[model samples]
Every structure is written in structure tokens, then in C-alpha cells.
Target: MCRWLAYSGTPIRLDELLYQPRFSLIDQSMHSRYGVETTNGDGVGVGWYPADSPAEPALFRGVGPAWNDANLREIARSTTSPLFLAHIRASTGTAVQQTNCHPFRHESWLWVHNGSIREFAKLRRDLLLAVDPALFPTIEGSTDSEVMFHLALTFGLRDRPVAAVERMAGLIEAVARTHGVPAPLQMTIGTTDGDRVWGFRYSSEGHSRSLYYSTETAALQRLYPDNPQLHRLSEETRLVVSEPLGELPGAWQPVPESSYGVIQKGADELGHFEPAAP
Candidate 1:
């Protein structure tokens, strides 16, 4: 339903990923080849760690569509960071408002997603009630994405990311099933604590939303030996996106349907994930 990308590596110009690629995130906002929709123009957000400070990331988000937002374009060109999160939204039953956009922040963490709750309204009340009281007041949006964020926080995401996320999925699925919502909750979530990045792709059913991660740096270097831009990157630089930004046939690999991946300083680690209760 949406498009997003998480990058961890050497500090590079934002334009390097959002504008320079053959099928950049900006380009995808106007022309997406594999997302549920061809256009994701409801809103956009970018979160990055400033070079001078790695623990806290600065986030800029707006209600306007990405392609038409000059401010977004300008920032993409001017800002640079080693770890960043970017999202282009295609609202699913939510208003096209700035708060509804993603890369939602809490202290040193940032998160984004590319899917929706099967019947969010039916379970919103119950889900909201389950959030940690301290974090509940901080949730400023109505999208399932934000709800999911709060859920993770409630489960202690800041302390145990993997387990918290697993609990989040479990809670979401349980509520959905109790309300009679069918299986297959399409979800592809990316989260970062300004250091390590975690990307998840899963559904209640076997098939989930499309998600891909770049090949290991050394492998990519071998494949694109003649490309200086690629060679300049360290053996650890890596990318995880909802869809491949370019048609680099061998550059991207699909994340297993029921799996989650972790990236730290450009290195990737992957594992299987169980569906939420539903």
C-alpha cells in the first residue's frame, strides 16, 4: 500500500538514494512498479541521524504528496546521514494529514510501515487500551502504523526489539481474529534505534507485502565492479526497501515471506517470524 526505504551505512547525500537511483523513492511516488498502488502521494516523511549526534534522529514530515513538495526535494538534496528512514504514503482508510504520515519517532527510535490493519476500527479501542500509558499520550496519529508503533513500545521495543515486535504482531492478529477479520495482514515494517535497523515482512497468510534487501556489500562490489559509486561504499553499507528502487536484477533479494531482517552498520541478519495471534 505504500513505499519506504531504510538505509544504514556511510554518510551520503540524501539525493543519492531518494533522487539519483534509476527508480528512486521520489520516482516511485509517481510510478511504482510493485506496490499495491501505482502512486503513494498522500504524504511523505524522512528521519535521519545528524552527523554530530547519532542517538537522536531529526524527522521532517508533511501532508502534501512527495512529488509536489519542494521542501522535501530541497531537504533530500541538502541533508546527509549514515542512517536514515524515508516513507511515501498511500493512505488506507486514514486522513491525508501530516501526523498520519510515518517515520514516527519516540526518543532515539524511528519507524515506518507499508500496510494496514485488516479492520482497524473494530480493534482500535482494544489496541489503544493495551499501549503503555506513558507512551499512549505521545501517539499523535490514527493510522494502524502508529498503533503498531505504540504496541511495540508497550511490549518494550526500546529494550528488546525482536521480542517486542513479535508481541506486537501477536497482539494485532489476536484482536483481528477476535473481531472476525480474515487472515493475511499485509505488513512490511522498518524500525531503527539510530544504530541497528530491523525490517519485517509478514502476513497472517503465507503471502505478505513485497520487501527486499540489498545483497551483501562484498557481493554487490563483485557484481558492479566497474561502478565507482558502489565501490566507494564500505563492505557493510546496506539497504532495505518495500520494492527495489532500480531494475538492478541482481542487486535486490526478496525477504522471505514470513521472515524479519536486521541491519547494523550495513550488515544484514535475517530470521523467521511467527504471525500475530489472528
Candidate 2:
């Protein structure tokens, strides 16, 4: 599995979370504490929404370990975004290439995932065949994560995200069952459309990968009374990650297994998540 994070709220420099945190994504790239593999150096990618452009988010990706990427560090220090998704890849039987990096994009949406479809080799063809014919040509990589993004798009992610993802999961499981694979899916996914962000945690056998979201800014401020930065961020600021970015007490909350949630301008919403009929 990989490591990833989705930030939504105030427009801030990427390094604020990517490099500055105690256990930042850059640190996770080489020494991840919670991922299946300690080193996720297969590839790395970052996607962020520019303040002036709402139609699509810009992406920067490379087929190198993030910790050693000078360009990544340069970009992280110079760029800022209101919303962004960053990922450090650990191949789950996929090639190490830019196309296989996470934070895959389609129009206004950006997506990243931290897990895989068990025995993808057994069901890859079937799953690809399930994607809408029009959308198939747009799939640029062979990784299950990118394929899963297109599957959600085919299932109507733009207008109905949660349901679209649920349908996508359903299709993966249906194909897996036909292939005799007991557990077909394992994912901790994050997706956004330059505005709101949605995150999901689920797997076929019930125990999914670890995922967490930052505690509300209000709570953090109270917990770290002397930390002025905590009080500067909006109360609506939120971060969903494969693991907590830091060890600050009460600064993160684990996302419950088999659930999904939305992060928007106001109050965030969390609810049960389950595959539905495709």
C-alpha cells in the first residue's frame, strides 16, 4: 500500500503538510510507520487547485522517491493551493512509472488511493471492460488505483460521488467473485473537485487500511493553546490522510472502517459506506 493526504480549506503552501509536519508525507515516503511497506519510493505525485482556475487542478508527478526529488521540494516550497492531494507510491504489482503515480486527474477532479484490489491480475481485464467505452481511452495507466478513478467517473462521480464510488466498488467485487477471489478490494481513497473532498475506507474482508482526518481547528487550538498557527487556520480546515501527519495530542481522528465522509465549506459529514448494486 501507499501513503497519501488530501487537504481542503485555506490556501497554503504544500510544504506546510508535505514537508513541515513532524511525520510529513516526505518522511513517510522513506519511513512510513503505518503503511504495509515502510518505503513507498516507486513514485510520487501532487495535484492542487490553483486559486484562479476552477476547471482543473494542475499535477506534478515523477518516477522517483519523493524524499530525493529536488523538483518536489522546490515545488512544495514555491506552490500554494486551496485544495490538494499528495501521494507516495509503493507499487502493488504495478510498474514504477509516472503514469502509475497517484493523484490521477480527469477534468476538475483529482484522486488518490492507498490500497489495492486483491489479485488484480485475475480481474483486471474484466474490470477494464466494465468502464464506460468513452472513458476507457482516457485511462493512462495500468494501476488498479487509476482504473478505480475512471470506474468512478464512468459510474457518475461528478454529480453523485458517494454513490458513484459505491457502484465502482460493487463492480470490482462482482468481477472478483466471478474470478473466485475471496477479497476483491482494499482502499482508503481521497478525491476532490476543486471544491469539496470525499474520502472512503473499505475492503472486502472488513478490515481496511488505516486512514485519518485532522481534528477540527477549534479543538486543536484548545489543545495547543500556545500554538498560534492553530488559531490562524479556518475552523473548516480539514485533512484526510493515510496516517496522522504528526503526533500532536488530539490532532487527528481515525476514520472508521467501512465509512466515507465529505469535507466542504461548513460542517463536515461522515456516514456509513457500503458497495451498492452497479
Candidate 3:
């Protein structure tokens, strides 16, 4: 299990979201209130698209707790981005290495997840074989999260993200069933291609992990009418996180179970998500 957040819209310093919030991702790393684990100390990663360079995101990651990383704090303070993804890892049977850290990237695309594939040891080989051979060499981590990213890529994530993810899930469940394992998939995932972000909440048993999106700007403006920062942000600004960054009333809305959302420059879109044939 892990914790992650994806931000889009206004360009803001990483610290404003990763550190300055009352319950920031860094705070969640040690005192997670919703994740399966209380401490996600295995590693941490941040991927951001510089305003001047949107085609590729710069990434910084390390094999240590995010709360204790001085460099992470410094980088957060200095960097600003309109779109970014950050993750804190709590190793789920995977090596605690930099490669296993998330916000994994490929060209302009980035992905992160906060759940695992049940009995992955038995299902790993079959899943790996399903990946496009060309992408197989890019598989650098043992974590199912990374494999799932590649699986979605192989299933055509670059073109049809929602359908690609559905197919990826369907393939995993199909393989697990053949191996006599039930309830094979569980995930709260986020992915982006520097333009739009997609988030999904699903599990084989229906009760997936927590995922929430920020309230619309109009609502936020009314909620914090006098807050200058809220006034400064664009109407399209949005944040999707595994848990609320703070306890601001009416600020976060839970992503419906078995649903996915698309966050972009205008009104967001929400749709029912289901696993389908690969």
C-alpha cells in the first residue's frame, strides 16, 4: 500500500501542497489517517512538469521516508508546477529501492498507485508475459504497481486510458481466476500525460481504498471567501489525493467506488468504471 496525490490547474510550489498543508503528503507518510499503513517509509517520489517544459516531467525520488528527507523539503520549496504527481511508498512485499518508488514515468506519461494485486507472486509471470515486449525492458521494479502501469501501457493506455485500465484489470482478474485466486485486484490509481489526469477507485470486492477530489473553485471560494490564495487559483484547478490534505470542511469529495474521473482544464468528468476483456 502507498499514498499519493495528483495536482493540476494553477502552477504552485510543491511545498504549498506537499508540505504547507495541515495534513500534507509528507505528514501522511508518517501519520496516514486513511492508507492501509500508518507509515509509508519505504520511499518517496515527486514528478512535475515545468511550466516551460510540459512534454516531460522532472522526477526526484529516494529510498527513505519522505518526512525525513531534507532534500525533498528543499526541492519542494523551490519547485513550482501546474501539474504534478507525488507518492510515498509502504513496501508491499517489494524491495525498498528507488526503482520501486512511484510517480513512475515514460516519456510524457506518469503513473502512481496505492494498492496491490492479491497473490501477485503466483500471478506475476502471467501478467508480465502479457505486457508488450517493447515495454518489458522498461519494467524496473518488482512492485505490482509498476507492472500495472506497463500493463496499462501495453493495453493501449496512451490512447484510451479509461478503456486501457479496464482491460488491464480484466486481464489481471482473468489470470488470477485461472490460478484459483479470488479477489485479485485492488487499486486507487492516478495517471497523466502532462495534459490531463485520470484517477480510478476499484477493488474485486467493491470496497476500494479512499480517493478524493477537491471541491470546485466556486465552492472553495465561498468556503474561504477571504483567503487570498483561494482567490488566486484558476477555476480549473483541481487536486486528487488518496486522503484529504487538510480538514477544510466541504473541500474534498470521495471518489465513488468502481468509478473513475478525468481532471483537465474545464469541468471534470466522472464515469462508472468496470473491468473489461483485454
**Which prediction has the highest lDDT against the true structure?**
3
lDDT by residue (1-278, candidate 1, tens digit) is 89999999888989899989989998999999998899999999999999899998999998988889999889989998999999999999989898999899999999999988888888899899999888888989899999999999888898988888888989888887778888726799999998899999888876788999998878888987898988989888999998898887699999988888889754367998875442
Off by over 4 Å in 3: none
Ranking by lDDT: 3, 2, 1
What overall lDDT, based on C-alpha atoms, would model 3 receive against the true structure?
0.94
Pairs of residues clashing in candidate 3: none
Ranked candidates, highest TM-score first? 3, 2, 1
Predict model 2's lDDT versus the native: 0.92
Model 3, 197-269: lDDT tens digits are 9999999989899999999987899889998989999999999999999988899999999999999876799
Model 2 TM-score, 2 decimals: 0.98
TM-score of each: 0.97, 0.98, 0.99
Tens-digit lDDT track of model 2 for 1-278:
89999998778999999999889999999999998899999999999998888677999999999999999999999998889999999998989988999889998899999899989988999889988999999999889998999999999999999999999999999888888898889999999988899999999999999999999998888888899878778888899999888888888899999999999988899999989866
Candidate 1: stretches off by over 4 Å: 265-267, 276-278
The clash count of every prediction, one per candidate, is: 3, 0, 0
Candidate 1 lDDT? 0.89
What lDDT does the true structure give each of the candidates? Answer: 0.89, 0.92, 0.94
lDDT at 100 for candidate 1?
Answer: 90
